[model samples]
Target: MSRIAILGEYDPTFEPHIATDRAIAHSSAQLGCEVEAEWISTPDCDRSKLATYAGIWVAPGSPYRAMEKLLDVIRYARENQIPCLGTCGGFQHMILEYARNVLGFQEAQSQENDPYASHLFISKLDCSLAGREMQLTFTKGSQIATIYGSLTAVERYYCNFGVNPDYVPQLKSQSLQITGSDSEGEVRVIELPGHPFFIGTLFVPQARSTVELPHPIVTAFLKTVL
Candidate 1:
């Protein structure tokens, strides 16, 4: 079976682990692949070592250390054309990594980290997204538009911060289209069109998925690799 690397941290879930695990595993099963969770501290990991996974999945967490490792992984994936999916903090870190490394914003940062990195792509939201609903708009000619077939809808969210409202314009101008958003049009999902698969969303798509009916995005992520 093909393998999908889940970049996870030493973390807990305000929700149940089984539910989250099932969401991911259910996606892998539908695509006939194996979902393997990779801890950031794994010994002997490197550029070449990372190439083994067909795709990568970033779970929700602090993403401090996991974010560093994911930066290297996503960079390699971006260059080599592998698939990746980042959800919640996973999504935040992906944007930060791309901004700091790929976009040459050396000090690009998240509110969770420095809180004043000058390029606040992430900031603590005025309200907790916990148990809240959101909507996102897919850009014309973008892959998400092709996937979801339209630009507007509601999604469940569980986050404190998102792509800072200010940087949304600059981010989209840089080919990182802010394809999705909340009802207020805040940035929600970001995507890179050129990559076979590289999409991150402020909402945790996995949480909304199930064995009987998995979410479209998560299923697409698995298909990207398989």
Candidate 2:
């Protein structure tokens, strides 16, 4: 049985976290595979411990107990090419991790974590997306487009921050490609070009998943583990 480490401080009150669990279960059954998912608190995560799992799902609900530790896990997965998914707050940290570690922007910081940082790669959205659903247009020929089987998808969001527009050009010039965007062309999903399954979305696809209709991205992420 393959095991997946869900990295986050599990909170019963968080609906997206709950949805993440259900989505994984639904995807597992659909794939005809038994996947054992364990929630690993961010503070207790380390590379050695994380290596035991076949994949990593950095769940929603951020401002984690140990931000550095969480980033360490993300960095480990990215560097080692481990299958990984990050949504909502996890998506924010994914941008931070890539900017600081891969793009050499050591000062890159999430405004939610450090509002006064010199370089705020992740900033508050002009309009909060909490409890809202929106349409996302996938980049043609991108991984997200292939998974969704269409150029457009309707996704859910519970986030208030996203990649700073000022840094979008710089980020796009790097290896990370903005694979999905909104009608206004704002980034909503990103994928690492050569990685096996490294993708992050500002929208929480898990929330829209069900036994009858499992989200394609969640299924795609699990498929990489198999």
Candidate 3:
């Protein structure tokens, strides 16, 4: 059985947190596979325990207790080629990890974590996306487009921040590609092409998942684990 370690501080009252667990079960049942998913609080996470999981999912609800610890695990996944999926706040921190570790932006940070930081790769959106359903377009030949089986999708969001527009151009390197965005060209999804499965979305795909119909993105992430 493949085990997935979800890195986030789980809250019972949080809809995204609850949906995340269900999404995993939905996908595992659909795949006819027995996969165990566990939530590891940010402060409790370390690379040793994380190394045992077949895949890593950095869940929503950011500004977690131990931000640096969370980023270290994300770095572990990226550097060691462990299949990883990030959504919402996870998306923001994933890019922050990439910026500081891969892009050589040692001072890069997320505004939510450090509002006064000098280099904020992730900043507050001009307008909040909370509880709003919006349309996003995927790069024609990107993995996201292939997984969704469409060039565009209407996804739901519960976030108030995203990749800073000022740093958008700097984020698209040879490995990290900006593959999905809103109609206005705001970055929403990013992918690491050669990794088994390394993708992050600004929208909460888990929120849209149901037992009868699992979200394709979550399903695809688990498929890579298998």
Q: Please report the candidate that would top lDDT against the real structure.
A: 3
Compared with the true structure, the alpha-carbon lDDT of candidate 2 equals: 0.91
State the lDDT of candidate 3 residue by residue for 1-226, as single tens digits: 9999999999999999999999999998899999999999999989989766999999999889999999999999998889999999999989999999988999999889899999999998899999999999999999999999999999999999999999987898647999999999999999998888999999999999988999999999999998
Which lDDT tens digits does candidate 2 get at residues 1-226?
A: 9999999999888899899999999999999999999999998989999767989999989778898899989999999999999999888899999999988899899888899999899999999999989988998999999999999989889999998999998898889999999888888999998999999999999999999998899999999998
Q: Candidate 2: which pairs clash?
A: none
Global lDDT for candidate 1?
Answer: 0.73
Model 2 TM-score (2 dp) = 0.98
Worst 10 residues of 1 by lDDT: 37-46
On a 0 to 100 scale, what is the lDDT of residue 197 in model 2?
95
Query: Which lDDT tens digits does candidate 1 get at residues 1-226?
Result: 6666666553555462344567768877777667675544422335677766888776676535645656777677777888988888778888887887767887778888787677787888988897787666767777777777677656777778777777766676677777776667777878887889999888877777878877778788878878
lDDT of 3 at 15: 93
The root-mean-square deviation over C-alpha atoms between each candidate and the true structure, in angstroms, is: 2.5, 0.8, 0.8
